[model samples]
Target chain A: MTDLSGKRILVVEDEFLVALEAASMLAEVGATVVGPAYHPAPALQFAKTEALDAAVLDINLGTGTSESIADTLKSRGIPFIFATGYGQLAGVDPDAVVIDKPYSQAQIVAALRHVLA
Target chain B: MAVVPQKDETRALLGLTDRLYRAQGLDDVYAAALDAIAVMLDCARASILLFDDQGAMGFVAWRNLSDEYRSQVSGHSPWQRGETQAEPIFVRDVRDTGEPDWLKAALAREGIVALGFVPLMANGVVVGKFMTYFGDPHDFSAHHRELAVAIARQVGFSLERHAAEKARSEAVRDLKESGDRFRLMSEDAPIMIWIADSQGKCLHLNRMLRNFWGVPDEVGDFDFTSTLHDDDRAAVGAAMAAALRDRQSVTVKGRYRRSDGAWRVLETTARPNFSASGAFMGMIGVNVDITEREEADAHKQLLINELNHRVKNTLAVVQSVARQTFRRDGTGDLEVEAFQGRLAALAQAHNLLAAEAWQSASLEEVARRSLNGDADVRIAIRGPRVELRPKQAVTTAMALHELYTNAVKHGALRSSEGRVELSWLTAEAPRGSLVVRWLERSPQPILPPVRRGFGSTMIEQALGADLNAEVEMDFQRSGLVCTIVAQLADTVRQ
Candidate 1:
């Protein structure tokens, strides 16, 4: 149905609105949404348990730990995208797509397809 | 007519010549001259016209002439006379024949005839001429014309001298009035105003100076040098000598002993009064009693010294209090820092009070300085500048320090994401007293402590006891706001 159709997607963001928007965008592209984590704890848990999925990660969580989540996602076969308010993420995976905040639904889908491919 | 009254005319001419010399001024000269000529020749009306530097004769001084005749003479200038072919001779032809002028008609209504012009000569200058109109055309003899010219010469010189004397009188009168006003003003002045000769002896002193030194008239000569302080008399003497020698103003500060034997400091600035020839007449000086101002400065210095002593002692006491309070218990629980904080607040209050010389301190200045350690411009303001007295300053300084320390330890400014909004404003009406509000707003939620801490108690006591003002501190859902009502009457007293 779309460029990201039948693709598994993971979303990570500290703000609830951002996390919900990423999940919706993945669903719009006919991709199955995995996790939309509001904190680094849930995001890290999702990165370790979920298999073969593309992930979106928020670089700054209120708890100040997002690097560990990015590192965990890199160990898995999951391709990821980083959503950060501040510039340049620390310890991000080499293959991950870095998208700044306030992204459109189209951009999320396009980035998911690129990361999955 | 066979030249009747020749002897009567000779006597009249001699009388007219004397009247010319006795003329009071220009207007008098013109009137007497015209009157004398008219009476001698037996004419109806007479007028004299004097030309100015512009050779224009607009001035007409007349005698026995009606309003109509004077107006006709004034309306015409000397240029009109020059344009006419009529000479300095008599005009016996065409009397009132040319125009139906109102002047001619008015004169005819009164029955008048021939007019004659006699040139009034002074220093060979054609200054003006005289004219006489008779009711009937009559022949004028040579003696009658010669008398008119003689009257004109005497009147001209007398008029010039009269004008000069009149100007001199006005100048003298004005100078006398101005000098009298100056003397009256000096006597009424609040300061001791005096005039002294080169030897520092009194020539004149105003009423204030006499009252200030308590010198009585029975004391005979009011000696200005006697009132000078013993240690300063020689210096003042030497300075006056120097001023007279150099012809410059002299200034000195010395004590002048009052009649009650009380010595008062006087700052005297004297300038040598001189005449037009640069001769030194006397010395005029204004004496100001600066004793009160000097005393106030000395008091302020003492306050600063006391403040220094207290600060050093408080620091030493605080160090000992810290050691005692901290090590009182075997187990160290970081408990003594709480006590250390309160002592530091008191010390800081003293520091600000000393900085202002105990006159008054700026409320905003104390607030900003107290909060310096806590935030860097994180606080927003909402009030104009307010001045606080010494007592209010010390109390407010202590309270501000407490607020700053508390905010650093617990409030919004502690966190990087947090912000503070401070609003201080006085009430609309500033009559007998004023209401001041200090409001603090932050995003972080804070509730008023169940029991008031040392900071809150001190803030209440400081405002209430020291400032004699009411204080209200509230920790609301939005933020903490403290409002105070202080009477400006007590704070701004000097």
Candidate 2:
């Protein structure tokens, strides 16, 4: 029920249905959605070029890891939470929040809100 | 009255008696006896004969006697066989005696004009006789006959002592030789071998075992448990003690540190050894190294664990996809059908992954498998062989399934006249890239949908996110065309 009015958030996830559901949930909270980049390169491109208030990143993007994208968001001071099926993320920043896969919409949105705060 | 003995004769008699007692072997006894006979009495020749099991007398020692004379006259004795109390036979002259003609001729040939035979006694039994021959016929003195009797008694006792001594020494030599042979064989053996006494004291260790333990050859009374790994020491020691107490053979496996400080797995088998009288003597053992086999077993266990983890993760992903598909507004049988199709696509990808040991799958193969329900004539797939890692293959299969579903519902595969061309090629880019194109040609005009559905979102967003690809889907009047370009080298895991 937290107000995400006028907040711009970028979502990066590999699964199409999962990413779409996550994007729709953010839109319902009144947050404008950016590219739900399926691959790391596009996600990195979005992280560098787009105007983002926050980001939701799937740790594994079928092609490789989203570590480069995570790095970009950190450097830009954009708050983000990691979404993954893995128990541990190798070479990832320890301070970053993680949301396990098959997560509920509430879980994703709340984790993002907490990271953004 | 007895004549007083001369000083030289008395000294000679004393020296001969000392030599008879000091004789070490049968040969020494024979030599000492011959010297005594020559020194004590006047004789042309002397011989000693002993009776064998068959009661036949054979000359064992002789002095200055021809082989022909000894052979011809050896059996001619004054007393019959087993005559233990017979008195000496004195032949004043061989020609005058009532002996056989051949015996007289043989004695005459050797110049024995007179001969005296004195019986030898051992343990109060007459065992043999000694003969003294004089060149000229003479009357026998009672003193000379008494001296001959004393010489035979000394010689007879010495022969018995020498025989016993020889048998004892031979037995000792045989035992030593057998022990030496056992040591030599153990030293050359490739496997570790050891022997321990009845009290569990180490008696011997082979060369291989010594080198493995970094111990010297002469090291004695070692406890093998000292070298055992800490975890296995107590148990192994207890098993060894139990086996020893039971006097039974035992086989055990344990870890022991080698000379280089590496712990190696060893299987040891010890068997109890016993004496001829069935007394427990000791144990002999052999050790074999099995470290490599143990390592291989551990590695297989680790792989099984990893496989279990992967299977659980895959199931979670499937669950997520199902929940998302059913959560959509106005979702019904059609949505269920789509979900089932996606699941089938995921299963096909897993099959390909399994076939390749979960390493990589061929891109062309995944495309063909995803579009399986469509007739062969409706879909044309053209692509060079390109292998994708497991993750890439699964994501690509889901994307292809969505594309096929759309084609069947609203695009090319809706009508018999429709056809879809799927082709992919690798391009040499900075990171090396692959470009896959799905071109649909339908007889009916294709129209762009007013709202983006799950299929379009998957073909564009999910495909790009998973593959790090640039996706473009065009809804043209003629057909629905989709183009995907992804970095090939960056996506594959080494």
Candidate 3:
């Protein structure tokens, strides 16, 4: 029931296979993928400079937290959902939606739709 | 003939006896007895000598006698050893007595021409003798002899009473000094100290313990169980009681509440105190605060749990990668090999992360590890030292692997003479940006792939997206060239 056509979504994930699958899934929905930045530096850059409708962010990027990117997205009024293997992301915004790892494609698309709506 | 003592003399003798009985010490008794004897006998000097352990008489008390005379004539008693019930010896004139010449000279030097030695009998034994010396020679009277005998008896009774009193007081003083020292030591000790009676009743608490419990200094006979944690009070109390009953030592750990309502872990060790006769006296205990040590141990356990959780999550990520890799069209055994290669790359990154406590890894290390199986003669790696965060390290490792696999299959590593040049450097202009390039060279004509496969897709799309870098892949006639430029400002240490 959700239409992602023409929408540009940023995907920030560290794991290569996960990032590729997420990009492929967004492309399947006719949505344009802006990026799948692996680390916090480039993820923040894309969040600040890119034309994004929504975003999927992994809370932990292996070395440190991706909290700065989440803050940038929040400041720009861009809707996003956290993609993490962890159950709880300490210090994150309480109202932000989180999708756990090994998540199905449908779960991500549904979360993105809910936030974008 | 001598007449008996008048009524006044009888009254004075009774008063002297009363005073002797009331004397508090040996000196007081000796003074009173000497005064009474001097007045009754009307003598110039008096002295009391007691037999020492060697049966030699030593002067115990004297009145108006020269020290030299007392010392020289101390052992010159008229009676032999253990000679009790003997009549008093009255020397009307020492010049005519058949005593030793030195004894006569010593007595004469002190102007004593007459003397009387009356034995002091106590419990029908002559423990000592008292002497009365007259300055002028005079004939003895029967009444005077009776007076000497009576005075010596009173002196013997008084000496015994005074000696008993002296011994009792010395014992009392020693007991008090020992108690004071015990209290002082316990009060100044850093740890809490306490004492309980044989019946398990609290008898004493040191100043430190009193302050800890917020109790007064004089507070004793209070139940210590009230200050213990509710859950541990019963057990600790039972253990202490059992130890007391057995007259043995006990060691226990429990939580006790402080005055400010904070609970602290305390380790108590108690041992039984005993008297010289081996009677069970009481229990003495010491309590040490161990709260901080317990907290530190708990914190270490939490860190270990977190590490185990992270390891499990890493394995899950590996599983997901395998699933996605095999879920493609035309996938076969080759896909398995490629998948295993990628998994190995991930594991290498993990090893580097683990070595650094999962903080970060080095860029040159990641690249070198990914090229592990490649022929060393055909590959050259040149780079400045650069460290990457854990996420960057894993992504870069996988990207490097894809490049290496491609070079082996169709590029520089496909032939023995072929060579691959891999190098990287940091850019200061953009401040913390890194550029890494891979160039392959061979004699065979190089050709570009007709369509993008998983390898190329990962090298260009996955690496670029994950690293947030600029990826450039050019299929030149010379060979396959790949350039990756990423800012390490946020990912790497300066």
Candidate No. with top TM-score:
1
Clashing pairs in 2: A38-B464, A38-B465, A38-B466, A39-B464, A39-B465, A39-B468
| Predicted candidate 3 versus true structure: per-residue lDDT over B1-494, tens digit per residue | 23546775577588779888888777777788788777777765888888888988889999999999988988866666577566788888989878889988998899999888889876667888888888887777887888888888788888766666677789889888887889888888988998878786777789888887888888766777787888997888788777767878888889988888999898899998888898888888998888999888666644533453365356546645665667664568567556756665766676566556567788878888789556366778888888888888888888889888888777777777888888988888676788989989977887887778888777877777777788999888768888988877666675
Clashes of 2: 6
Per-residue lDDT of candidate 1, residues A6-69 (tens digit): 7777777666555655676577568788777777777788888876467777666767757887
lDDT of 2 by residue, B74-145 (tens): 666665556758678777777877877877777777788988888877656677888888888867787887
Candidates sorted by DockQ, best first:
2, 3, 1
Docking class of 3: incorrect
Pairs in clash, predicted candidate 1:
none
lDDT per residue for candidate 1 within B159-263, as digits (tens), equals 556756888899889977986677679987988888777565776677777888887633356786677878998888788778788889888888888878899
* Candidate 1 residue-wise lDDT at B164: 69
Chain A of candidate 1 gets a TM-score of 0.83
Where does the lowest 10-residue lDDT sum fall in candidate 2 chain B?
B304-313
User: Model 2: residues >4 Å from true position, as ranges?
Assistant: A1-117, B1-17, B38-45, B49-60, B64-68, B71-97, B113-129, B135-150, B183-190, B195-211, B214-255, B264-284, B288-494
Candidate 3 global CA lDDT score? 0.79
Models 1 onward score TM values of 0.43, 0.36, 0.37
Clash totals for all models, in order?
A: 0, 6, 1
